[model samples]
Target: MRSRRARVAVIGVVVGLVTLAGGCASTDDPKANPSPPAGGIEGTVWVANEGGHSLSVIDAASSTVVTTIEGIEGPHNVQVGPDGSRVYVVSGHASTVAALDATTYRLASAAPTGASPAHVVLTPDGQRTYVTNYDAGTVSVYRPDLTPSGTIDLGGGPHGMRPSPDGSTLVVANLKAGTVDLIDTRTDRKVAAVPVGGPAVQVAVSPDSRYAYASVSRPPSVVKIDLQTRVVAGRAEVPTAPAQVYLTPDGRSLLSADQGSKDKPGTALSVIDTATMTPAGSIATGSGPHGVVIDPTGRRAWVTNVYDSTVSVIDLPTRTTVATINMGSQPNGISYAPRPPAPAEPRMSVVLPSPPAESSHGDHGGHG
Candidate 1:
């Protein structure tokens, strides 16, 4: 759906591979106001780096980086807007969706979508903003202060997307038509599709969203769906191409992130166990593993290899990997904001760039 380049030639390998995971993440509630104190981290994680066309803000207590925000180009997935103060990024070479300002990182508006947005979803009272559009299958939506609010035509290659923690529904995955669609967020329409597997690149739910997972990158499985009888209730192989599935702020467990076997690229990380959803172990990490966060004290988990630019971290009760952190280029998407970056000034403008040399790489809408 997109590939024009020059977002820093590919911001260190497409922002470490479009990472994302947030249905709510904070941890040690001393009343909860953690992060940023160690060095930096007042909410903001959209990394993609793609060699630095833009997007970098790190500071998660000195993880570093802290600044870098430009429009969008080869960007890929990154979300945080919905009143958390904006961040939505998704640009496979400017198909468009920028909208920054997660506290002065800057930019603030872009929109255009419908070719390769690849992923984005919001509406827990942040108003609305869907995006998706992999190669023009379509999805647009908008309005959390950005406007638009229209488009919706999916099928074929939509990539991993979620929304159902009682928000009404909006699931989508459609990778090459393996299928998922399901829309309806209060009558935006569509309503059904459901197939799954063989391609489904990422999708997660379960904090009472009633279950809905999907990771299938060609037989390297993890399908399970049931969101109120939409169907396809089974599947679970994961080890190779399962590119992202997050969920575990207590919802039990379901982490996956495989990126392996593209000629043994394998680095692993599986983990399942959602009350017997199966496959409870795998670990290893760091090679090309693309996106899979978990900080607010879920014990640990950072992952973001994208061809070893580095980031493993992990630990979570001995899942392993302990520390890696090299983070330079090709490190796709990853986000977090238990709180940290609003001391005034910075409002958004972090520019880091200088990596690119790696390479690159969602979902939503329609059913009728």
Candidate 2:
């Protein structure tokens, strides 16, 4: 097995190819592309720059970085409120979750957590937030004010988590324990635990919230769990070392960012048909594609290339990459917040001269 440093070296080589193949050609001349406006754009893509210790907010429409928020240490994951009024970030190194104002990107509040908080998800009602504590082997629950509401103990390595569509349940993937835990939101307790093959890393819930697809790293497969039955329903073979799984808005398709193996680190995203429970296709992406998110319109999907420090924008309809966005070091976690609508265009008032008032015959008589 290659050491961690050696793996990084290999990733760097792959990233070089990504830049060349994906047309991410870099230039030193800053004038080539001007900076975007300071104000955040509606439907923005927020990326956690783990190595840079910052959050990069990108304008989805323009495909440009709108702003970079600094001082966040090891921001592993991010989530935006349903109404797009608040943004939450989980800092693994800092062991805290920071809540930020959606408009100004200013720190609103922060809640302490156990060691190595890996990911966060918000309830559908936007009243509560749940965070996965990787090292602590528990899930931390928080209120909107960033106050601790409760905590649910779980198996070792509670890493990735997502709330059910209806906000009735929370699904957590335990890496070390190699199991998936389901928690009842109403009762605030673990309802079920399903043993996946091994090292379940990330999960994505279906649109109806009836099923959850989890990426298992050990055997390299996506396991589908029936939420109602709380049992393993099926599995789909993906590329080796699937790192993250995401379901499109319609929930008809599932996308997996396969991290590949020691011999072959994945440089592609696998597309699966949820109905058929089979691999439909694959879209070539940059090396180390870690985070995946779809736009509100469901027209495009943004994927973060960790090793390349870039984001690949894939046109959903075409299933082809449309653009590559350059980012800071090791861009990993990403979330999409619909840009607030632009203020209505100022109403313009125009005074037009009234039509010659019924002067047809009268004007003729005056002329005579």
Candidate 3:
């Protein structure tokens, strides 16, 4: 998303507030579900505060900032490790990734990565982590203990690294190259490279793992890829410049953050119905909507207005902006701690369950 002089200044201010201000689950949950609230405190959402150079911990249930961890430099993408033991944040400027203890939100360790590490993702076992190095055109794999495992050379600069549902493959978006590189997780080798929409910024996988979607910014479209065929399945256009793409918890909808044009600034959060790949509606928000996230129930979505220094809260059911809260500074990434479903009473066992098959599991340039 781009804007003129005044808008640019406003965007900077919003990002600054985000850095300075620094900023779930339920039981009654379901059978086989582990309530996020299983622990004492409410579930926590870990956000990488880019401008602030820190991490923010928010209680999902209260929607309140609980604590802040300082000393990070230009953190971009943040991911929670499997077992919920650690949170990994990538430093786009520092060329490093920080490991934080999940409970205390304290720095566990820091590992040097490739140039401009933009995002981080953990494996299903939380035993391995992948950091996308944009300028370096590589993906750095780290051990759960924060040790460097190895690096995979992607053709172009790599940005977003996401794991497949079955945990079998890791798909990365090569921003400048306009291709998605599939990595064999077990061997850390590039398996395939498939072209997609222009300037792929973010990637997401469907619940069924049959499709992988990448949000392309320049053309402002979401590119859907057929997992089996490795081909472009479909594309959905979004207005203006689409930044972050979020999938509803129930996997029924896709939300695009449309940071508006120069004069008007701000943005519009476009809601797309996944069934038809069509936009359902849009909610106006502060200037420069950068990142977005949905509540576990898929009932509400929270968006960060990078230029306005506020968060627009959208009521999914009503399809409107119900409230706007000042978050101070540029908020980049948003996530919620989904509460585990309530536990069900154990009945007499009919038969022993078989173990399910194990699974596996961009870009660009300038401020333009």
Candidate 4:
């Protein structure tokens, strides 16, 4: 979920409303033979430039901007297909999900969504896509080709969410209601809403799908909820108001992007030890750290500092930020697609779809 300052500061933030830099971002380590990336980064990090109304593609190994894809209106969130052939983006201003060809950066098709759309998440199998509608209180489902499937109403501002690794359940944060709702994937039906102590912003489901870690804005904390028992198991305090929660690949630690409000911006990324359910430590980053994704190796993480308009690359093993990439304004969301580019050259492409050209690519796959 985006911060209150962003929605207020940037109209495109689809923050429909509101809307970085660093004092602490760094460079390659010099102690040992420096690796291009701290933890041998791979793939690319796609960032949703909510204010800029574009997407910035970062080359992981080199930690540089390969390109900036433009022409989508107010993209708040972006998700890549498993094969890295497609990218799904939800625009709050357009109230639609635009599926674009990843390589060509062309809008393949677009499907309308609910009011005040927030985040977008695809099923692990990539058969289904879910978009959270904040004002309408529903989640819009779509086929891989961007065709409308159905809708699930959970009420009270459904914002950030994640599907379980097992592909059986979807856990979402209801910002307006201060609760988390679970949906059964097979039936697309409401499972349960477990209330936490504060406004739930974003979520990270455990690799096993047995637990969920929700980022709570107020009180600045992370609450661990047992998915099976449907209750709060533990709560850990963070440095500031966190936006996104991500679990390391090994599931040993949960990284919380401490994105404090613009009026009171935070400068750190909070870490929670999953086993002990306590604060592991904090990593200084750019201001208003928003979306975060860890590398497959679990040794590195990339964080979007919304206020600073920069990304901090964290070396997880040292609990430190090893690099920062300057980006377009107000980078709100981040996703890692673990596939190498064909030519691996820098690209700056802009796709403006004509009325008829805005159509779907053939089906990628059926529901698994």
Candidate 5:
């Protein structure tokens, strides 16, 4: 049973939008599953403005808002495909997941999921997409074409999910269950569940895929779990309420966007060293930093501040915020896409041997 507020939120999106398609497909059908694109479009950050019901595209280099896509109902999370061809957005209020063209930012397709589809993550291979249903206690699986493929039951509030770097496993943070569900993507089934003793908000797997770090809100800590043993390896203290956690590209540092206390209003990002399992330092961000994503180069990090309706760009090496860009109302979700480097200009074959010979002879005469 959902609360009245939750019910109202779910109902709000249904009023004026077209109904999403509802159907399921077999995972083994080759025609139903297409391989992900080989490359992705780079140099843009996509953000989900939950309150504004829109998506904001920001130019990574200039830190400017390129565009704001309207008409999305409660866009709670946003993710770009590995190849950068498509963008996926989860509308919790609409109970739907919509796919948009990565370059044009137009709606490509959409499909309904369980109640309160909160977060979405695509497989590294880009063949599949997994979405966590916050209130339904389930995860919906979709093919690359945005067709619903199947569903996995977790019996808890499934909020945040991430696939391993190798695409072998999917780690889901069950917010209400206070446990982490590990799913083997090969079979698309839950293989194990580890209790973390608090409500889990987000999960980030190591680059090597050996461990997964989960942010626990109740005790204000992040728990490290050994993927092989399926047990709690260690824990590190964080801020009062950590909304999202992500690992750096090098897997050297784990960053948490701590949404500080309501009275205090948190504006800090907690940095944890993976080796020591302790807090290394904290970088100040905007008010209510809820989501974070690191650039492909690992030099800069972008964080969405919900309360302030802005995004803070952090310089990782200096551990300081370099700029803050104003976003729409309550920007909650963010993702990074690496832009392809510009092609090098063609070089002209200049004949400089005659000049060099003259310079050599003249320099010898001057020395003599």
Candidate 6:
């Protein structure tokens, strides 16, 4: 959500008294679901610490930050290459897409983009990477190496988006336009703009690519659109304001990261059943839970609680939070990749200094 500046500003008191800091489940207890074995949950969990100007690299199994790569100026979101070879981040202030070596957290390359880049997505096949330039009203396209390929003028506030599983289409939620742009992946051109109720915040496409779901924040609802016909099929009203939306690996349910405002932060994740396009239930989470992503194994979902500055590990089976991880600052977007282990002695780059990993109490940027 581009709501970061306002949200952080609303609660600047918590941001001070430190650069202050730092979870899931129906019980909202880390112990509700016991921690997994060393290899139980594989891969790396990447989080964009917007306020801290850093990214938190966490080992999924141990729920620990392997390292913090600090220096990104206002990283709104991050995405890992499908093969886990690299991670791409879109910095709103820097107006560039920074690609880092996944193995050593070293900056490899970067390409310029339009104003206020909000989110980044890599095609599942690793063929291309896409970034939403929020203020520019365009989506930036790039080769796998962060090479600029082209740009699609999406018309307004292009925010959260995802490529269809087959990599055929990219479903993008245009916030200011209040519409969803279905862009043909092959051509990088807009195929259609289907209207949502209002201010579409984020989107999730069905596995088959037959349907696309868009979340509207004003009225707090999820709009289900038929991708094949480009029609709004159904809409379900949710209780909390939704940020990022995710379709479970099995495609049975959709999870909405309900990150309400600072005055009334969301305390749960809203669930919608795909079968009926209706409310299934809710999973308790930390305050202002913004970014939610499920693991490759489909057994757990990790979420970033923005206001709390913590990450919650959810045990999918029981819908309970298994662990809460401390983070640096405002953790916005999250992405996971089944990755190999790092070197014996990993070192940080001279450009990217280490940021203090805070608990639920500290870290705020100069929101003013």
**lDDT of candidates 1 onward, in order:** 0.63, 0.72, 0.63, 0.75, 0.74, 0.76
Q: Choose 2 or 4, whichever is better by lDDT.
A: 4
**What lDDT score is found at residue 155 in candidate 4?**
88
- The positional error of residue 11 in candidate 1, measured at the CA in angstroms, is 30
**Candidate 5 — number of clashing residue pairs?**
6
Off by over 4 Å in 4: 1-39, 342-368
**Per-model TM-score on C-alpha atoms:** 0.33, 0.82, 0.77, 0.86, 0.82, 0.85
Q: After best superposition, candidate 3 residue 309: deviation in angstroms?
A: 2.7
In candidate 6, residue 222 scores what lDDT? 86
Writing each residue's lDDT as its tens digit, candidate 5 over 24-96 gives: 1111111222222222224888888776667777767666566667777667789989998888997655567
Clashing pairs in 2: 42-339, 43-338, 43-339, 260-266
Candidate 2 vs 3: which has more lDDT: 2
Q: RMSDs, each prediction? A: 17.8, 18.6, 11.8, 7.1, 19.5, 6.8
Give RMSD (Å) of candidate 2 vs. truth.
Answer: 18.6
User: lDDT by residue for model 2 over 1-368, one digit each (tens)?
Assistant: 22222323432342211111122233211123244332223467888766666777776766666667777765768888788888888765556788877776778888777656778899999888999876567899998888899999995778788889999999998876888899999988998889997778889998898999998876778999998888888999876777778898899899998765323557889999988789999988887777898875667788977666677888888888777777766676889977742222111111112223221111000000
Error of 2 at 126 (Å): 0.6
Model 5, C-alpha of 345: deviation from truth (Å): 30
As a whole number from 0 to 100, the lDDT of residue 85 in candidate 5 is 83
Model 3 whole-model lDDT (C-alpha atoms): 0.63
For model 2, the stretches where C-alpha displacement exceeds 4 angstroms are 1-42, 261-263, 340-368
